[model samples]
Target: MTTDSKRKGIRLPRPLAIFVWAYMVWNLLPVVAAMAFSFNATRSRSQWQGFSTQWWSGTPLSLFDNEEYTAALKHSLELAAMTTVISTVLGTLLALVVTRIRGVAKRPVNFILMIPIVTPELILAVGLYLSLTFITVWPFSVVELGTPAQVVGQVTYTVGFVVVIIRGRIAVLGDGLEAAARDLGAGPIAALVLVLFRLLMPAVLVGAMISFAFSIDNFVITQYLSSDSSTVSIPMYLYTNARGGNTTPALNALATVLVVTTLLAVALASLLYRWATRRESVASDVTGTVALSA
Candidate 1:
């Protein structure tokens, strides 16, 4: 029998497919509802009166027209941008070092790097909060509880994610390419920069996108580190109004924007990863052809 015929004989039950579909709808239905409500003409999120852009940009009560909402959104974007750049750079360097170095200290170094990844966010937030408050050192003293502290806190948790991603990429690429570059008379730094880093660009981009998403969605750390109203992110603002039950549909509009932005970042990362992998394959094929010809 053909592979398709054999698989058809052993196919999953109809109920299983129905269950999976149901589960997806259960998970995504709320998000779809929220996005839909953002454009509702009426104030009630529970009941959609009619389709309108009032919450988004229709008038005085729209998200764009509201100063507080606009400010919070701007602050979130800034924090995400700063966190992505810093964490990606530091994390990429750490990954390269960890992958190259070999010693008794490697395990300890790796364990230290992973602590934030598995630790509770609340604990990490509190620890960061206390350090910034009591640690009267040169940089710590200067780092007051505000946007600066928020950025640092976000970076602390996010750098590990970047490290994990780039490290996985490094593990896959192996040492063969770097060794070949060195054999071609390239110095260590030159090989790393020109060969390894170029190949690792997709993973780096993925890490940056992940860091940006995490930073933008972070609430606990931002809340603990925020000094004033100026440092309030979208999540913090949403929490404040949401708890009070006085929020308008404009809040939904704001949430939709956040959802769309995060989805876009993730989509872009996937596209870039595919492109990078394709380019790498082409380069490898060319190199192999040259070697065979020689």
Candidate 2:
């Protein structure tokens, strides 16, 4: 009964497998319908008349120019890029600082950063909106928020998630690698360049991608902080179009693009990380064998 298994002996439970399939179907049903409807010839999303790609082609063009899908896409991309750069820089610094901390202060700092992550988005959005009010601080008019301020506000909440993710990676990367490099006469910066940066690169990249996706899909925070119609992102565009007795096929098309892009990037990142880990594991095993033989 205890025979060797070539497949690593890992197996999903029957009930668990059933549940996973059911869950996937439930979650993907709407997405699947949207994608299918994106290609439908009819204007109505409910009826499956026939297949056409007009939504994909000439999207937001002559027929759909009023939707503002093109402008909204540009806005979302710009906002996502800004959020990614700011969050990645801030989060990486947080991870680096966390790695250097070895005392009681670490827990409190981490808790404070993580508190925003666990807080409900609705509550956070409302709080951010209230805080932006013209209520006087020291009798002077408070700094009024615009699109840039909205991005900053959202990034504040986003940095917390990024920090937690990168911190976990940094924690796993113990001090031994840096110690070895230093013992070999490298300076602190040199040691970090030679040891720490290479090891934590994958985690940092993954964290950045996650932050980018979150920033792009963010609705509640952006909704609360949003000021001008010009600041409208793709999510906000989709929201208003979905409501207000308006239904555009371009929204479906945009959803398809978002889902595909997100999935592709995530899949590529996962594969890269797995391949790197596998190579490292194999190299370590080979080195261990050589050392044992010696």
Candidate 3:
């Protein structure tokens, strides 16, 4: 008779396999396709004529040379960078208060935060337009509701997501460490700064990065709120070109870049998380070993 210890285990659970398959087909496959087509030379979409890098440098980017593409790219980069910083700061603050405080403001702040993330972008866009348009009656105080408006609007949407992310991490953040720091002749603020803030730094970085990605791709609010061509973001530019029946090889090129950048950031975030957890695990193991040795 065969020993039970020698028997092979069953394959992975069916549900996990199915989920992996579904996700690969629906989300991963299309991205892979676009990436592949970035190098494909075809006048028409979906028909791979040949492989070429013409799409990338095929057209020289210049102000007179339709640098709208270049301009949009730069604009988006700036916006994303700004949005990331502001949202991270605001979100972390919001998360800290909401999680640590107890009052009417906690629920209200959370509710308001959820509204931006959960509500449809289209509805938010239209609502913003109405609010901005109508609120401006006086010449001096009447703020010009435009690209600057869109920047603020995008921030409104993105900061909420950042809040949710930071809050999730904050919930799991143990106060025991901070308490001990305080016990060790440290002030409350000092304990929090040295212990709590340092501990949550990874979450803060990841949240800001995630918010940056989202803000980079936001189109609906940007389109509705942006008044002129000065602040046209890459997403808005792509939407216009695609919808207006203007097909270009560069579209695939740009898409490929976006996909790669997104994947890279996601990979980086995953790596950071793994590294952080691994460090914690190693420290725990060392502590356990020393205790056992003692």
Best by TM-score: 1
What TM-score should be assigned to candidate 2?
A: 0.87
Candidate 3 lDDT over residue span 145-222, tens digit each? 665676678788988877777777767766678879988999988987888878877788787778777878888888
lDDT of 1 at 83: 99
The per-model lDDT (C-alpha) reads 0.92, 0.76, 0.74
lDDT, model 2, position 272: 65
Q: Sort the predicted structures by lDDT, highest score first.
A: 1, 2, 3
| lDDT per residue (tens digit) for residues 49-157 in model 1 | 9999988885888999999999999999999999999999999999999987789999999999999999999999999999999999988899989999999999999
Model 3 clash number: 0
For 1-294, candidate 2 gives per-residue lDDT tens digits of 112243267789999999999999999998899878888886777788898878766644322454477667777778788988899889888878876777899889878878779999889878777776655673223545557656776787788877877777777777888999999999999988778888878777777777788888888888777778878877887777775445756678877767776776677767766765677767866776678677
Backbone clashes in model 2, listed as residue pairs: none
Candidate 1 clashing pairs? Answer: none
1 or 2: which has the higher lDDT?
1
How many residue-pair clashes does candidate 2 contain?
Answer: 0
Worst 10 residues of 3 by lDDT: 1-10
Candidate 3 Cα errors over 4 Å, as ranges: 1-11, 14-19, 61-66, 137-143, 243-246, 284-294
